[model samples]
Target chain A: AQSVTQPDIHITVSEGASLELRCNYSYGATPYLFWYVQSPGQGLQLLLKYFSGDTLVQGIKGFEAEFKRSQSTFNLRKPSVHWSDAAEYFCAVGRGSNYKLTFGKGTLLTVNP
Target chain B: DVKVTQSSRYLVKRTGEKVFLECVQDMDHENMFWYRQDPGLGLRLIYFSYDVKMKEKGDIPEGYSVSREKKERFSLILESASTNQTSMYLCASSSHDRLIPYEQYFGPGTRLTVT
Candidate 1:
């Protein structure tokens, strides 16, 4: 079975500060990782995904993540944060041909002015 | 762009009542999924269909059943709604193309409440 763990349950950052959300996964084989964001009362939107080839993946709204094989981590990062970026973020790992994803508990991001 | 739409945005049902949640995708995706979201837990897959008439149980499919009569639509059913089933239901679809297989596009979601 595959699983994802997001160490931070909630994160608070200033509007202009840089941010990083940690994610770790337990998978037997090469993992397909993804980051998704959900705003209050809205469905989730894909921030980015890492399938293969690249260790550093770029996503929408000026976000990026680095996949580290040794550490089993795919952490999302942004140089500057905005108030609108406050939302609940999830990390997921996909395995097998069925395309089933195992998601983390989620990290709630709070942007302080 | 892919568009996934659910039948309702909010629903209130009584305990033991039958509930149906419909999902339709416009992009001709080969796969459709039903998931439930809670406060602390992320999305948990209830059921998924790879092709018409083919359904698979996900991690938490005990109290849920699904129907996929058409390629573009997938429906999730709760035989008897319970208070524990009150949560946000999300519908998503993804292409099965080998090149890009797992990026799922989601609908706005239906918030279901059972009392």
Candidate 2:
């Protein structure tokens, strides 16, 4: 069974500061990792994904994630976050032919001015 | 761009009442999914359909049923709405093209409150 763990439950970052959200996965095979963001009253929007090739994958809205195979982790990062970047972030691992996803508990990001 | 739409943004339902949640996708996606989001729990898959009229149970599908009568529409049914079922319900669709990894596109979500 594939599983995802997001260590941070909540994080507050000063506006324009760099941000990093930690994610770890447990999967037997090569992992398919994804990052998603959700606003207060909206559904999830895919930020980025990693299937193969390069370890560093770029996503929408100036987001990027690096997949560390040895550590079994895919952590999201942004060089400079804005107030609008405050949202709930989720990390997921996909498996099976249908590409079923197992998601983490999510990290709530709060950006301060 | 792929667009997925759900029936409602918020719904209030009584316990024991049968609840129906509708979802539609515009990109002719072959896969549709239902998931519930709760505080402290990110998302739990309830059901999914790969093709028209074909459904599969997900990790948490005990109290839910689903129907995919057409390729563009997927409906999630709650046999008897309960207080525990009060949560944000999300619908998503993705292509089954083997060349791609099937990244999902989600709807705005419906916050269902069962009283």
Candidate 3:
């Protein structure tokens, strides 16, 4: 079955430090991948998506993700972390043109000043 | 900006009470979905509607029903609220056009607690 996995339950980073959140997916076909961030008590906001073409995709709030097909990974990265960047991040996968999404449990990010 | 709104941010109810959780989307989306989020488990789809009066069972549809009387509104019903049913409920909507990769827009979730 198609599924998404976020290995990290929580990650803490110092302000201005580089950040990376890992995601892995298992699917038969070329998958549609996405990253979403949710602040406490708020709905999820789309960060980035990868469907086809360039493996590297850029998202809002200085976030970027790379889709590595060989590794079955789509990892989110940020050059520098801000206090406001602290939030829960989820990785999701969709097959073909379907809208149904399978989401990872999520990784809670904490930024310490 | 796409706007999806849920009727409540927090709700508490007894175990046997019938519960209604409402969702409305301003975007004329053809597809709407209901999901529950727990602490360790990610969001699990409960039900979805493709069009008015059309519904499909999602991965976890037991103990839950849905109503989509109008295009812009979808409601999730809990037949008999149980403590195990206490969860953060999220509503989402997206366009159905196959050409455009559907991007789901989410509403602020309603935290339901069944006692």
Compute the lDDT of residue A105 as modeled in candidate 1.
Answer: 93
List the pairs of residues colliding in candidate 1: none
Candidate 1 ranges beyond 4 A from true positions = none
**Model 3 segments beyond 4 Å from truth?**
none
TM-score, per-candidate, Cα-based: 0.98, 0.98, 0.97
lDDT tens per residue, model 1, B5-114: 99999999999999999999999998999999998888899998999999989889998999999999999999999999999999999888887768888999999999
Q: Model 2 segments beyond 4 Å from truth?
A: none
Task: Please report how far candidate 1 places residue B25 from its true position, in Å.
Answer: 0.5
Q: List the residue pairs that clash in candidate 2.
A: none
Weakest 10 consecutive residues of candidate 2 chain B by summed lDDT: B94-103
Q: Tens-digit lDDT track for model 2 on A1-113?
A: 88899999999999999999999999999888899999999999999999999999999999999999999999999999999999999999887667578899999999999
Higher-ranked by lDDT: 1 or 3:
1
DockQ of each: 0.77, 0.79, 0.73
Question: Per-candidate interface C-alpha RMSD?
Answer: 0.9, 1.0, 1.0
Task: Give the Å error, residue A34, model 3.
Answer: 0.5
